[model samples]
Each structure stands twice: as C-alpha cells, then as structure tokens.
Target: MTQRVPHVLVVGGGYVGLYTAYGLRRAARKGRVRVTVVDPRSAMTYQPFLSEAAAGSIEPRHVVVPLRTVLSGCDVITGRVTGLDHGRRTATITPTEGAAYDVGYDHVVLALGSVSRTLPIPGLAENAIGFHQVEEAIALGNQVIDRLDVAASQRDSTLRTAALTFVVVGAGYAGVEAFAELEDMARDATRHYPTIEPSDLRWVLVEASDRILPEVSDSLGRYALAQLERRALEVRLDTRLVSCVDGHVVLTDGTELDADTIVWTAGVRAHPDLVGTGLQLDTLGRVVCEPTLAVAGCRHAWAAGDNAAVPDLTGEDGALCSPSAQHAVRQAKVLARNILRAIDAEPLQSYRHRHVGSVASLGLHRGVAELYGVRVKGWPAWLLHRSYHMSRIPTFNRKLRVVLDWTMAMFFRREVSSLGSLQRPAEEFRRAASSTAPRAS
Candidate 1:
C-alpha cells in the first residue's frame, strides 16, 4: 500500500504564509508533505520598509519578495480563498480570471492577515487612501510629487496652499513614519521647483490618542513629537477627523484645513474572510488558536499572525499575542514545526517568546528604539532600525539589493519625479483611439 503525503494549504502570502512554507521547505523537498500558498498578490511585501519605499529611500520593487521565486518548493496560486470547509479539509479558491475551484488539503494554515481598519467619517471613503500596501506607498509618493508640481504651477494662492497641504490620520508606526518620511521627501523635492519653498508645504498628523508612537515608550513618543514639531510639522493629538469633503478637512476640535492628500493608517482588523471559514473566532473576528498555534477545536487546522488570537504565554494572564511582524514571523516558525509534529503524532511545542522591543524611523537620520528595556534615539536608533529590518527582510538577494539602495542614496539626491500616469497607462491610448475614430454617418 502506498502512503498518502499530507497536503498543507497556506492561505495568504504575507509574513506568516511565506515564513511557514519556507520553514517547511526541507520536509517538502523530501516529499514528506506538499505545500501550496494562495494570495491576491504574487509577492510578499516587507511592510516595515514601505515608508522608505514611499520616500524613495528604497526602490518599490525591492520591498516585495516574488512568491514564486522564493517559494519554488511549493505551489503558488495567484488567487483568493473565498471560503473554507475545514470539516472536509477543503478550501474554495477564486482565481484572478476564472471560476472558483475547490482545493482539498490534509491540513490548513490560516495566514489571511489583516486589512486597513477605517471609520465611517464623512467623505473619508471618497477622499482618503490607506497606507498598508506597497501600491498605496507608490501612489502616495507619486501623489505628493504631483501635488508639488500643481502647487508650483498654480497662480492662485489658495489653490496652491490646498495642493501643498497633506494630512495623515492615525499616529501609529505606519502613519507617523509615512508622515515624517513623505514630509522629508517633499521638503527635499522643493529644490527642483524654483517657485516653491519648503515653508510652503504643510504636513499635518492627526491622532485620536494623546500621544504618537504608542508602540514605543512615552518618553520616546515625546521625543518624536518634539522632533516633528521642530521640523514645523503639525501634530494634532486627541483630535479626530470630523470630515474631509472635497479636500476640505474639518476636525473635531473645530480646526479646518484644505488638503489634497489624506492618508489613513489608523489600524487593521483581521481578514474579514475568516467569518466564512466557520472557525472559532474571538469578538474581534480573529481565529482562536492555542499557544501551539493550532486552531482551537479544529483538527488538522492551524493559524497565526494578525488573523489568529494566539495566547501570549510570556505576558500577563489572558494576554494574546500582539499583531506585529515580530510575533507573526516567530509564530510562523512555531506553527510550521507544530504542523509537522502533528503529522508525526508527536508532542507539539507552544509558541512563546517575550517581545524584545520596538523600533521606528522618523525620517532619514532620525528614529526611536527600545530593546530589552534599553532605550535608544537619534542617529544610533536610526542605524539600529535599519540594521534590524535589514536582517529581518527575507532572502540574501533582497537584503543585498536594499543595502545597495541605501548605499547609493547616501551619495545621490533622492528621485523626486512623479509617475502618476502609471496609474492610468491606458488613458493616452484611449484618447488617441477616440480622436481617430470614424464619425457617425
């Protein structure tokens, strides 16, 4: 009788999906198990570097790892997992350009990850853009430069002021870094526009909370606030965006401003698709998982990362792991090993690790970091932030490329050109075709 090899279906190609499958490569090569990864995009984005990518400190392409290239040992499906029937060990996958199909699996890894968590502020849906993906980062960079160009050409002072103003909601890592870095980029870009001065630009960061960089120490947050204020950037705390209708921003504190760009990076919720998986989920809609990273009450099912509520053994009682890359990457390794152990009917180890600390870049040569209760700031923190992420971004190829980007950036001025037309590459062709079309008789 031939033995049946277990099929592991990993949903979502983010940190957990990529790392878990990469961890199982040895077993996969030996034919001990078969692995398949599914995601909307074929590449896994290193999100921590997105701010730099947006600021042109690193090339946008360098921040994402091509899933097919990295996961050559596994099957890569360019699609979305619409639903899951874990009882039958099957998942329904909807491809980018075809009918939905069912994929049978012996085990499943729910790494669906999270999406931008937005509020129902008036006109927000129409005017705001999220900063969670590389595409958004690219669009934002282009938009900033394009706005600068518009401001420089406009004769009306009010219109130019509106074009020069940029607003970023939420002061978390994503928002603060994006706010700082893009401001730096635009400030440096003013040199190219002889008509524009750095003083003409207005960068505003609004956070409902009382402080920014909540992930770091309060002292560090204060320092970041001081640094940003010193740069003449507006940091509004304990303030909410009441409305942003047609580039007109109204705040809860009765502040009104005209801003052409409004960035949303408040927070993220677990993948909404989990509701259809029929798995046990917490009130927050995250899959409930044991410390071993196995889905609770579900056989042959596993989960980790932002999608799963895994217990934090190192924290106080009833504390769940935080949905950060630090936890997600570590959880992936433990999840993979536990899956293999389950296949072998061996003891499973629990996922437990005290978080080392946090690090965030304010902009070039400015940052804040806390490691093992030791706080660091300024240039040393900036270097630490770079070195740490450089070590974490997967693959030596990507690492080398990123290093080279930084090395070159040290000697050359950052590119400030806008390629907004890339967003509508077919517009020109369509216009030309319409112009040459035969007139109706």
Candidate 2:
C-alpha cells in the first residue's frame, strides 16, 4: 500500500511564508509532508535591505529571493488566496489572469503578512506613496533624484522650493531609515548640481508621538533624534499632518510648507483577508494563536508573522509579539517544527524565544542599535547593522552578492541617476498617438 503525504499549504510569500516553506523542504524530502507556498509575487523580499537598495548602496535585485528557486522541493504558486474555508480544508486561489480555484490541504499555515495602514487624511491616497515594497523603494530613489533635476532647472523660486522639499511621515524604523538614507543620497548628489545646494533642500520628519525609534531604548532614541537634528532635519514630534491639499502641507502645529514629495511609512496592520476566514481574531484583525503558534481551537491550522496574534511568553502580561522581522523569522522555525511534530504524533512545543535586539542603519556609517540590553551608537552600530542583516538575509548566493556590492561600493562614489521614466513607459507612445489625430474644421 502507498503512503499518503500530508499537504501543507502556506499563504503569502513574505518573510514568514518563505521561511516556513524553507524549513519544511527537508521534511518533505523525507516523505513526511508535501509543502506548497502561494503568494501574489513570485519572489520574497528581504525587507531589512530595502532602505539600502533605495539609497543606491545595494542592487535591488539582490534583495529578493525567487520563491521557486529557493523552494525547489515544494510547490510554488504565484497567485493570491482569496477565500479560505478552513472547515473544509480548502483554499480559493486566484491567478493574475484567470478564474479562482480551490485546493484542499491536510494542514494550512496562515502567514499572510501585513499591509500599509493608512487613515482618511486628505490628498493622501492620491499624492503620497508607501515605502513597504521593493518597487516603491526603487521608485523613491528615482523620484528624489528626478526632483533634484527639476529643482535645479526651474527658474521660479516657488517651483524650485516645491521640487526640493521632501516630507516623511512616521519615525519608526522604516520611516527613519528611509528618510536618513535618501537625505544622505540627496546631500551627496548636490555636488553634481551647479544650481542646487544641500542647504536649499528641505527634509522634514514628522511623528505624532513624542519620540522617534520607539522600538529602541529612550537614551538611544534621544541620541538618534539629536543626530538627525544635527544634520538640520526638522524633527517635529507631537505633531500631525492636518492637510496636504494641492501639495501644500498644513501641520497641526501651524507649520505650512509646499512640497513635491511625501513618503508615508506610518504603520502596517494585519491583512484584511483574515477577516473572511472565519478564524478567531483579536480586535485588530490578527488571527489569535496559542503560544505554540497554532490557531486557537483549530486542530489543523497554524499562524505566524504579522497576521497572527501569538502570545508573548517572554514579555509583559497579555502582550503579543511585535510584528517585526526578528519575531517572524524566529517563529517560522518553531512553527515548522511544531507542524512536523503534530504529523508524527509528537507533542508540540511553545514559541517562547525572547527578542535578541534591533539594529537600524541611518545612511552610511551612521546608526543606532540595542542588542541584549547593550546600547551602541555611531559607526560601530552602523557596522553591526550591516553585518547582522547581511547574516539574516536568506541564501548564501544572495549574501555573497550583497557582500560584493559592499566591496565594490568601497572604491566608488555613489550612483545618483534617476530612472523615473521607467514608471511611465508608455507616455511617449501615447503622446505620439494623440498628436497624429485628424484635425477638426
């Protein structure tokens, strides 16, 4: 008689989905299980390196892992999971250009990651862009450099000022790192532009909270704030963006400014698709999971990453793990092991690992880090920041490529060219089509 292999279907190919599939590959080879990963994108982005990619320090190609290549032993589907009926153990997946279909699974892993959480601020949806995806990071670099070109060429003061001003909302890790990296890049590129000076470029960091880098220690956050202030960046704490109508920014603190660029890195919440899954979720829409990373009251379901509200055994009372890469990567290991144990009739273990630390790169050779309760700042922290993330990025091939990128960068000046035209490839063709139309009487 032939043996049956348990099919494990994983949703969303972000950090958690990639790692979960990666962990299960070896087990699948042993004929214990069959793993399949489904996501809208065919590649998984190493989000930790996105800021550097935007700053032109690393090539954008090296920051993503092709799901099929990494998960060779497993089934990889480039599609979105629309509906998940867990009671029937079936998931409905829709491809880019086809009808939705359902697939059955013995065990399902809910690793669907978070999306940008935005409020109903005016002109936000139309004007501002989020900084979560690799494409956004790449486009941000082009947009900033392109703005410099416009500012330098424009003769009008208002036009130049608007082109040169850059506003960044949210002071968390993503917000701070993106602002710092792009600001540094702009500062470096100013030497090439005869009409533009570094002093003329306005960089503003707005945060509604009292301090920046809230994930780190108070002292470290203060240190980071001082460092940014030293660079002449307007750090407006306890302030909110009241309106950005017609590219004119009005702040609650009565500060008004005209800017061409606004990057939103405010925050992210769990994927809303979970709301349709009929699973137990917290008020925030995250799937409620036990300490062992299993969906509570679901026998064959598991959850992790930003979409899961797993109890934080190591933190304060009734605290859930923060939706950070550190927790997601670590939880993937435990979740994968618990799945295998469940299949083999072994007892499942709880996910109780404490967070090691967090490191942030504030442009080149500038950063702040808190590791194992020991705080570090400046160049050493910067080195630690690069080294730590380099080690965490999956696959030796990607790691080697990243190291080579760093090695080549040491002997060369930064590249500051803009490829913003790539975002609108058909613009010229459309203009040509419109110009050749028949004339009216």
Candidate 3:
C-alpha cells in the first residue's frame, strides 16, 4: 500500500494568506505535504491601491492578484470555511454552489482578514457605502459622476444642492485619500457637464477623532486639515454623522447638510466569527498568538495579520502593533518562516519590525508623508506615496499596469464616465416593463 501525503489547509487569500501559501508551496515541493487554500474571492486584493483605483489613478484590475494563476501548484478551492473541527483535524467548507464538505488536514493556518467595522447609525446601511472592496470603489466613482448629471440638469435649487453635496465619514488613511481623490475628480468632472462648476459642489468630511490620519506625524496631520479646508471641504473634526435620511446628513454639531452620497471608511474590526472558535483572543477580539505567531494552546494551528494581536517588540512592554498593512505584511513573512521551522523541527523565529512612518495621498500631485522621522508635504510627499506603494504592490504585472495608468494620467484627463447602470442592472428592464403595462387600464 502507498502512503498518503499530509494535508495543510489555509483559509483566506488576502495579503497574509497569499504570502503564507507561497512559503508553504515551496516547502510542499521538497516534502510530502499537500497544501490547500480556501477563499470565497478568487483573487487577493492589494487594498492600499483601492483609493487610487476609486479616483481613476490606477486601473482596477491592476490591484488584484488571481490566486489560481499564482498558486497553480497548490489545491485551490474557491470556498468559505464555515467550521473547524480542530479535534478531528478537519474543516467544513462551502463553495459558491454545491453541498459543504469536510476536508481533513494535518495543519491549518487561519489568515482570514478583517471586515469593515460598522455602527448603529440611522439610515447608514441604506444611504452610505463602504470602501473595502473593488466593487465598492468602482460603484462610488460611478455614483459621484452620476450626481453631477443630476445637478446639471435640475433647475430647482433644493434638488441641485442635494445632488452636488457629498459626505465622507472617517479621517483614517482610506477615508482621507479616498475623499481627496474623489473630490478632485468630481470637481474636475463637472467641467464636462458645462452647467456645474467646482464652486457649486460641496464636500464634507466628518471625523469623530481629534485629527485625521492619526498614524502620521502630528504636524503632517494638521497640514492635511489645512490643505483640505483650503479646497472648500468642510473638515469637521471631533464630529460625527448622527443620522442621514434620504439625502440629508445630520451632524452632531446640530448642522444638517443635504448630500446625495455618503461614504463610510472609519475603520475595521476582526471578523466576529473568530469569537466562537474557542481560540484565545485579546481585548480587541483578535486571535491571541505568541511571538512565534502560533495560536496559544492550538499546537497545530497558527494565525497572523489583522485578525491576530501581534506584539510590538520594538515598543515598550504592553504595546501591540497597530492593525495596518505595514505590520500585516511583515507578520506574514515571519509567520511563514516560523511555520516552516515548525515543520522542519528548527527553532521558530519571532516577529520584530520597526514603525516606518506613514503616507497619504491628497489628490493630484498633493500629499503628506512622514518617513524615518522626516516630515514631507505637497508634491514631494505625493511622489513618496506613489513610489513606496508601487514597490509594495505584489507581482510585477500589477506594478507595471499601475505605473502605466499613472504615466497615461499625466498627459490626459482622468476618465469621467459614470456607469451607474452597474449598480442597478435591471433598471432598464424595470422601466420598460412599467412603461408597457397598458397605462394602468
């Protein structure tokens, strides 16, 4: 009888998952282990470029990596792992279709990332959108352009004002970059409408925090607030959206602004399902792992990235690394090497990386960056934002495509067509059906 190969199941295909799988694949080729990866999405998305993608600075396809193309050597399954039978060393997975199946594994790595954290704000779900996925970014772009159309055509001031007003809630990197980029695009896009000018548009940013881009230096954060305010954007720090009904956004400052579009990019939390796993978790609900990145007491399982509470050895005691891509990417490499060490019976290594500062894009040739204790603003910071992220965007193909998009954007205007139809695919059919319904005879 022939002996069977030992199986290792990896859940998720995000940044942490992709890098970890890459290491495992190399190890499997040299040994008798079979690696399997499961994720609902067919690709891994480099989320940092999402703001650029939304503003038409980079092509959407360039930021995503198809897992099937890169991990051809591994058994790839496009499914969601619903349950883990740790005692039996098996996991239950549910694909887009078909019944769930239990797959046995000798080892498991849970790299499932964080989701957009939300609150019980009134009318948010119905009126606001998120900035997490490619679809959301694309849809938001389309929505922004479509609002200009309504503003240009409507004669009533009430309707016109509502159409031109847009609100963004959050001051983090995602929200600030996205708000600045979209504001620039929307203002420039109005030129094509002829009837609407940049002055007629209203952009409001509501951040409950004391300052925007808290990860950056205090001076740069203040600089960002000034830059945005100069562009006529309402930067309401220490304020929040209390309620938004239909097209009106009510703020905590007792001000009501009528806006047709709202975007929510406040922050993210660890996936709530992690709670029931019985895995050790910290106060933040992130998996509690040792410095080696292995889950406490779960001998055969390990975790890292946004879903795990990784220690900040560079900081003093009782401090943890902020949940961001900077830490997640480094953790992935360390986690992968540690897992290999465990397999080969070598001493496991600990994760140790220092903070490298942060950067934020504030639309067309404008930005803020703080690197290695040096503060930058304006065009120099913008260049750094592009240069640093360009190198970090995994895969040469994606990097090349993004570079080409930027190169083209330099000489030509950003594309301004709003494919609003993408949001409601059946709108045309519904209109036709209603029109041909015998006139309510």
Candidate 4:
C-alpha cells in the first residue's frame, strides 16, 4: 500500500511564506507532505535592510533571498494567489505571462503580506513613490542622485531649488531611516560637485501625528526629532499634505513648497486578497486567527505575518500583535511547527512572544534603540542596529555578503552615482533609431 502525501499551498513568498516553505522542505523530501510556495515575486525581500541598501551601505542583491535558491525541496511557483476557496480547498493562481489556474491543497497557509495604505490626498498616487520594495529603494537612490544632477546643471533658481528639495512623508522607522540615509548620501556626494553646495539641498520630513517613531518612547522620539533638526531638516508635525499638484506641495499649516522628490511611507494595510478569501477579518481587514495561528473559523487553514491579526498574549489586554518583521519572523517558526504537529495529529501550541524594543538607523554611525528596557542612542545604537539586523538577515551566504559589504565600505567611499537611466534603458536607442529613420514620402 502506498502512503498519501499531504499537499500544503503557501501563499506570498515574503518573510512568512519563505520561512514556512523552507522549514517544511525536509518533510516534503521525506514524502510526509508536499509544499508549494506561490508569489508574484521570485525573491523574498528583507525589508529591514532596504534603507541601508538605498544608502549604499549594503548591496541590494544581498538583502533579497531567491526563493528557488533557498527552498530546495519545495515547489516554488512564480505566480500570484488571486483567490482562495477554503471550503473547496483550492486557490486560484495567476502566473506572470501564463493562464490562470486552480491549485488543490489539503492545507493552506495565507502568508500574504500587506500593501501601502494611501489616502485620497490630491495628486498623491500620481506624484509620490513608495519605500517598500527593492526596486523602489533602487529608484529612490537614482532619483536622489539624478535630482542632484539637475540641481547642479540648471541655472534657473526655481527649478534648481525644486530639484534640490526632497520631501519624505511619515516618520516611522521606514520613513525616518529612508530620509536620513538618502539625505546623508546626498550630503556626502555634494563634495564632488562644485556647483552643488551641501546647504543647497533641502530635506523635509512631514508626519501628520504629533510625534514620530511612535514605537519608541516619547522622549526618544523627541531626541530623534532633535537630531534630524540639528542636521537642518524641517520636521513638520501636526500638519497634513493637502496637495502635491505638479510637484507643488501645499500643507495644511499654510506652508508651500516645490519638490521634485516625494516619498510616501504613511502606513500599510493587509493585502486586499483577504477580502476575497472569505476568511474572518478584524476591523483593520486582517485575518482573525487563533493563538495557534489557525484561521478563526476554518480547519486545515492557517495565517501569520502582517496579514493575520493574532491575539497578543504579552499585551495582557485585548490588543492584537503589532504588524512588524519581529512578529512575522517569530510567528513563521511557530506556524511551521504547528503545521507539522497537525500532520502528525499532535497537540498544537499557542504563539505568545513579548514585543521586543525597536531600533532605527539614522545614516552611518548614528541610530536610536530601546532594547530590553535599556535605551541607547548615537553610535552605539547604530552598531547594535547593524549587528541585530545582520544576525536576523536569513541565510549564511547573504550574511557573509552583507558583512563583506560593510567591511569593504570601511576602506572606500560610498558609491553615489546616479543610474536612473536604467529605469528607462530603451529611451536612448529609440531616439537614435527615430532620428536615423527616413521621413515618410
């Protein structure tokens, strides 16, 4: 008699999906279960290191883990999970450059991550960029450097000032770190341009809330605000961006400016696929899951990471776990273990881990951290930030590469060249071909 191997379909190859699939690969090899990981992206991005990559502290390639390289024993599908029917135990998959199809599974893990939440502010969607993915980080670096090029070459003061001005919205870890890192890079690069002065570049951070870095204590947040202000950055609190029409910014506080660069990092909501999954969700549209990380009203279905609202046992109140990389990574471990137990008909354990403190890097040799009730600021915090994230960056290959990048950076100046043209490689060729073509008779 032949044994039947269970099929588990894991959605979204981000943190949770990658880790879960990686963990189950051994079991999959032994024929206990067959695992398939589905995502639109072929690689899992380590988002914590995105800001550093943008700042040239670490190479972008080192921050993302290729799914096929890491998950050796599992099937890695480069496709999007468009719809889920838990009752029917099937998922609708739409592959890039292929026909849509359904995949059957005995168990399903919905690790679909979140997307940026944007408001209806005028001209936002058309004008601003996001800071979530590797491509965006790369584009941001190119954009900043290209802006500097424009500032250096343009004799028009209005256009030059607009080119030099950079605006970053939201002051969370992503917002603050991105703003600081890019500004630091731009400031450093100014030495090479005789026409561009360091003081000529204007970096502004705007947050609608009264405070920044709300994950940290109020005092620490105040300290970060002061540090940024010391660098001559304009920190706008209690203000809203009313419009950004044609790069002309109008704030609620009657402030107006023209900036060629605008970055949005306000917040994120769960992937909209949750609504179509027909799963129970909280008010915020995150899947409601039990402590064991199982979907609230379904068997053979589980969820974790940013998409699931798991109860925070550490909070001691009715609070749910905060959507963060810390919780997502930890929950993936627990989620993998429980799935194995379920296959073996063993008892499952609950996911309960206290929230650790937060850390943020403000450019090279500067950071702020609150860890285990101990607050550290300045250079020490920056070192700790790098060390902690380096330790958490996934594979040994990537870890070694990141260390090599840091070690090499110590001996050489950071690369600040603008490769923005890579975003549109065919433009030059198209222009040349058009110019050489014969006119219509």
Candidate 5:
C-alpha cells in the first residue's frame, strides 16, 4: 500500500513564507512533503532596499524575488486566502479572477504579514501614498521627478512652490530612508533642469514622536537629525499631519505648506485577514504562537513574521517577537524545520534568538548602524548597511543583479527621468480613439 504525503500550505509570500519554503525545498524535491504558497503578489519584495530602488540606486526588479523562480519545488498560487477552517484542514482562496475555491492541507503556515497602519486624518487617504510595496516605491520616484518638471515650467510662484515641496509622514526606518533618499535623488535631479536649483526644493519629514529612527540608539538618532538638517531638509519631531487637502498641508505645529507629494510611512499592523482563520489571535490581532513557532494548542498549524505573536524567549517574559525582517527570516528557518520534525514524530525545538542591533541608510555615503554593541556612523555605517542587506536578500540571481546595478552606478549617473505615463497607460490610446471617432450628423 502507498503512503499518503502531507501537504503544507504556506499563506503569504513575504520573508517568512519565502524562506520557510526555501528551507523545506530539499524535503519537497525528494517527495518527502508537498508545499504550496499563496499570496496576492507573486513576488516577495526585499523591503530594506526599497528606498534605494526608488532613488534609482538599484533597479526595482532587483529588489523583488519572483516566487515561482525561487520556490520551484513548491506550488505558487497568486491569490488571497479568504478563509481558513483548521478543524477541517481547509483554506478558501480567492483569486484575482474567477470563483473562490477550497484546498485541503495537512499542515498550514500562517505567515500573513503586516499592512500600513493608517489614521483617520482628513484627506489623508485621498492625498497620500504609503511606502510599503514595490509599486508604491516606484510610483513615488516617478511622482517626484514629475513634480520637478511641473515646478520648472510653472509660471505662478505659489503653484511652483507647491510643486517643489515634498512631505513624508512618520519618521521610522521606512520614512527616514525614503525621506533622505528621495531628497538626495531630487537634489541631484535639479542639475538637469536649468530652471531648478537644489535650494528651490523643499523636503519635510514629519513624525509624531520626539525623535526619528526610533529603531536605533538616541545618539544615532540625534546624528541623523543633524545630517538631515545640514542638507537643508525640514525635520518636524513631535508633530502630526493635521490635514493635506488639495496639496495644502496643515501640521499639528500650526505650520502650513503647499506640497504636491505626500508619503505615509507611519507603521504597520498585522494582516487583517486573520479574522477569517478561526485561529486564536492576540489583542493586536496577531495569531498566538508557542515557542516552537506552532499555533498555540492547534495541531499541524504554525505561524511566524508580522502576523504571529510568538513569545520572545530571549527577551523578558511576556514579551513577543517584534515584526522585523531580522526576526522574520530567522524565525522562518525554525518554523520549516519544526514542520518536518513533526512529520517524522521528532521533538520540535523551541525558537529563540537574541535581538541584534539595527542599521539604517541616510542616503548615499551616509548611514547609522549598531551591531553587537558596536556603534558606527557615516560612510562605514552606509557600507555596512549595504553589505548586511546584500547578504540577507534571497537568491543568488537577485544578489548578482543587484551587484551589477551597483557596479554600473559607480561609473554612471542614476536615471532621473520620470515615466509618468505608466500611471495612466491607456490615456494616449483613449485620446487617439476619441479623436478618430465618427461624428454623428
């Protein structure tokens, strides 16, 4: 008689899902276990390099790893897991088109990552864009360049000032890097426009907290503040974006400015889809997990990354692991191994790792890093930032491409041209079709 093979369904294709499947690739290739990954996006983005990609320091394609290419041994489904019934070991998938369907699995990994945490600030949803995905980053880059074009050609001083101003809300890693990198890119871009100067551009970084880069040390944060101010960029700490209606920005500090670009990088919340899973979630809506990275009290269910509240064995009691790539990547290895061990009837090992320090880039040739109790800043930190992320981003193919991009960038200038037509690809066709339409007499 033939034995039935266990099917492992991995939800979400971010760091956790990708690395977990990659870790289990050998077992999958040997027919020991069947693995399937499902997500809305077919590619997994290396978020740390997004700022560089937006700033044209790296090609956008190089920052994203196509799941089918990396997880060749696993089934890749481009859809969302709309519902989960662990009691029946089934998940409902809703594809981009067609009807929804259910798939049965012996084991499931809930790796649903986080989404941008937004507030109810008036006109925010309509006016600002989030900096959490590859598409958003690319659009933002194009928007900045397009604004430069608008600023250079506008006749009215108020309209020109509005077009030249850029605002970023939230000063976390995403916001700070985006703020600095985009500013640097725009400053360099002014050289191409004879009508625009570096001084003509206005960059603003708004944070509700009292300091920027809260992930790093206070000293490093202060240094980052100094660096940004030196570049003539505005840093507003302990301030909130009160409103941004029609490109008119009103801040909590009573300062108002006209800005055509507004970026929201506040923070992230656990994926909202967890409610449909019927799994136990914490107060913050994250799935509750045991030390072994298994869903608490559930059979053959596991979770990690931003959506799982896994106890941090290395931290003080009652503390859960933070949602960061460093922890997510490390947690995935353990999660994969434990799943294989469960199939073999072996004891599962607990997940535990001490928190390492943080690193962040402040545009080209400048950064801040704290590694193993050693603090570094400036060019050394920048190099460390690039080197660390380079070693961490998945796949030799992507790594090689990224290296080539940097190699080419060393001898050539970054591309500043904006392809704004990408935002409206059918506009030209629609216009041409309308022009040639037969007149009704």
Candidate 6:
C-alpha cells in the first residue's frame, strides 16, 4: 500500500493564518503533510498601513500579500468555511460558485480575523464607512479629496460646510492615525482650492474614552493630543457620536457637527461567527486556547490572532495582550512552531511576551512613541513610527515600494487622483446609458 500524506487545513489567510502556514511549510514538508489554506480574500493585508494607505503615502495594492503567490506550494482554496465539525474531523466549505463540500483534516488552524466593532448609532451602518480593509482606506482618501473639490466649487454655504466637515469616531490607533493623516492630506489639498483655507476644514476626532491612545503611556497620549490640537483639530475626549443622520453628527456632549465624511474605527471585536462553532470561545466569540495555543480541551485544533484568546504569559497586570496585530503576528510565529512540535511528538511551549510600547503618526512629519518606558515625540518619533512599521510591512516588495513612495513624496507632491471608479466602476457608463435611454415621459 502507498503511504498517505496528512492534510493540514488552515482557515483564514490573514496574518496569523498565513504566517502560521508559512512557518510550518519548510518543516512540515518532510513529505509528510500537505498544507491547505482557505480565505475569502485572495491576499493577506498588513493592517497597520491602512492609515497611510488612506493618506496616499503608500500604494494600496502593495499593502496586501497575495496568498496564492506566497503559498504556491500549498493548496489555496478561495471559499468560506461555513461550518466545522471537529468531532467528525470535517469542515463544510462553501466555495464561491460551487456546492459545499466536506474536507477532512488531521489538523486545523483557526485564524479567522476580527471585524470592525460597531455600536447602535443611528445611520452609522449605512452612513459611515470603516477603515478595516485597504479598499475602505483608499476609497476614503478619494472621497476626502473629492469632497474637498466639491466644497470648493459649491456656492451654497450650508452645502460647502457639510462637504468640508469630517468626523472620525474612535481615538485608538486606527481612528487617531486616520484622522491625523487625512486631515494633514486635506490641509495640503486645500492649497489647490482657490476659495477654501485650511480653517474652513473641520476635523473632529471623537473618543468615548477619557484619553486618546490610552494603550500608550499617558505622556505620549498627551503629546498626541497637543499635536492634533495644534493643527486645530477638535479633540472630543470622553465623547462619542451618538448619532449621524444624513451626515449630521450628534455627539454625546449634546453637540452636533455636520460633515459628509464619517469614518468609524471605534474598535475591533472578534468575528461573530464563532458563537456556534463548537469551539470553546470567549464571551466575545474568540476561540479560547491554552498556553500552548491549542484549542482548550480539543484535540487536533489550534487558533491564534483576533479570533483566539490565548493566555498572555508575560505575567502582565490585568492584560491579555489586547487584540493588536503586533501580538497576533508574534503569536502566529509561536503557534506555528508549536504546531510542528505537536506533529513531531515534541513538547509544546507556552506563549509569553510583553507589549513593548506603541507609536502613532500625527499628521505629516509628526508622531509620538513610547518604547521601553521612554517617550519620544516630534519628527524623531514620526521617523521611528515609519521605520518600525515599514520593517514589518509583510513582503520585501511592499517594504521597498513604501519607502520609495515616502522618499518621493518628500520632494514631489502626493498623487491625489481619485480612482473613485474603483468604488463604482461603471458609474459613468451607467449614467451615459441612462441618459441615452428612450424618454418614457
């Protein structure tokens, strides 16, 4: 009888899932196991660059890692795994255009990523866009620039004000960075508008928390606040958007700000699908794993990243390594190694790491950083902010391109051409076809 190779099924191609598979491929290929990865997206996104992608500092396409190309030797399936019957050792995968099938696996890696955390705010779901994906960030940049043009040409003051006003909900890394970067880009864009001054622009950053960047040291948060405020941004602390109706933003302070652009980056919660997955998940739908990254009490299953609540072994004080990409990527590496060890019948290891610090970009050439208990600000912090993340921007192809974009941006102007067509590719064609339609009236 011929020997059979073990099948390893990985769900979700995000950082944790992709890296987990990538790390195991070299070792798992003793001609013993085959790796199969499934994800809805064709690529993995480096989420930290989302803010800069929105700011036109880096090309959007470069921020993504094509799963197929990167994992050519591995089986890549583009489908949604709707159900998992771990006991039956089978996963029900619904392909994009085919009937569902049951794929049996010897081992499974769950890396389902997080989704945008939302609240029950009026018109938020329909009116506001999220910054979780590259498409959203790039579309937002186009919208911000296009709105600047619309505001400049419109004669009506009411319409102009609404067009120029912008509201960003959340003061975390995503919200703060997006707000700062977009505001900076818009300020520069306003230079081309003959009628609009930078003062006409209204940028409101609303955080329900008492402080912005609460994860960072208090001093760094203060530095960020000072920097944003110096640019005349409305920093609404301990405040939130109660409702946004037709772009009329009502804040918790009983204040209403009119704006056309409303960005939602409040926070991220685990994907809600894990509720009935038969896996041990936390209250937030995140799979609960042991210190060794194995699904608690479940054999042959493992998890990491936003979808998994692995114990933080750093002996931290009231912390579980908040669901940040920094932790997820590191966790993925360790989880991968442990998985290989598990296959080889070796001892598993515990996952432990301290969150060193946080850094954030405040507009152009300005930032704040807290590393090793030391705080930094101004251009140096900004440089560190760029350096650290640029080094972590997935593949070398993306890293080189991002650095080039930044370097070129230093001497030349940012490319503001909006491919809004990407959002609605056939918009013009539809308009033309409709205009040519026979008039029924």
Report clash pairs, candidate 1.
none
lDDT of 4 by residue, 318-433 (tens): 87999999999999989988999998999999999998899999888999999998999999999999999999988999999999999999999899998899989999999999
After superposition, candidate 2 runs with Cα above 4 Å error = 432-441
Higher TM-score: candidate 4 or 6? Answer: 4
Please write out the lDDT profile of model 2 over residues 380-404, one tens digit for every residue. Answer: 9999999999999999999999999
- Which whole-number lDDT from 0 to 100 does residue 174 have in model 2? 96
What range of 10 consecutive residues in model 4 has the weakest lDDT sum?
A: 313-322
Question: For candidate 6, which ten residues in a row score worst on lDDT?
Answer: 313-322
What residue runs in model 3 are displaced by over 4 Å at the alpha carbon?
Answer: 1-3, 429-441
User: Whole-model Cα lDDT per candidate?
Assistant: 0.96, 0.93, 0.87, 0.93, 0.95, 0.87
Q: Kindly list the per-residue Cα lDDT of model 5 for residues 349-383, writing each as its tens digit.
A: 99999888899999999999999889999999999
Candidate 4 or 3, higher lDDT: 4
Task: Compute each candidate's TM-score over C-alphas.
Answer: 0.99, 0.97, 0.96, 0.99, 0.99, 0.96
For model 5, state the Cα shift of residue 247 in Å.
1.8
Per-residue lDDT tens digits for candidate 1, residues 1-441, read: 999989999999999999999999889999999999999999999999999999999999999999999987799999999989888888999999999999999999999999999888998999999999999999999999999999989999999999999999999999999999999999999999999999999999999999999999999999999999999999999999999999899998889999999999999999999999999999999999999999999889999999999999999999999999999999999999999999999999999999999999999999999999999999999999999999999999999999999999989989999999999999999999999999999
Q: In order, how many clashes per candidate?
A: 0, 0, 0, 0, 0, 0
TM-score: which is higher, 5 or 6? 5
What lDDT is reached at residue 19 by model 5? 97
Name the regions of candidate 6 deviating beyond 4 angstroms. 28-30, 316-319, 437-441
Query: Candidate 6 local accuracy as lDDT?
Result: 0.87
Between prediction 1 and prediction 3, the one with superior TM-score is 1
RMSD of each: 0.8, 1.4, 2.0, 0.9, 0.8, 1.7
Clashes in model 3: which pairs? none
Quote the positional error of residue 244 for candidate 1 in Å.
1.0
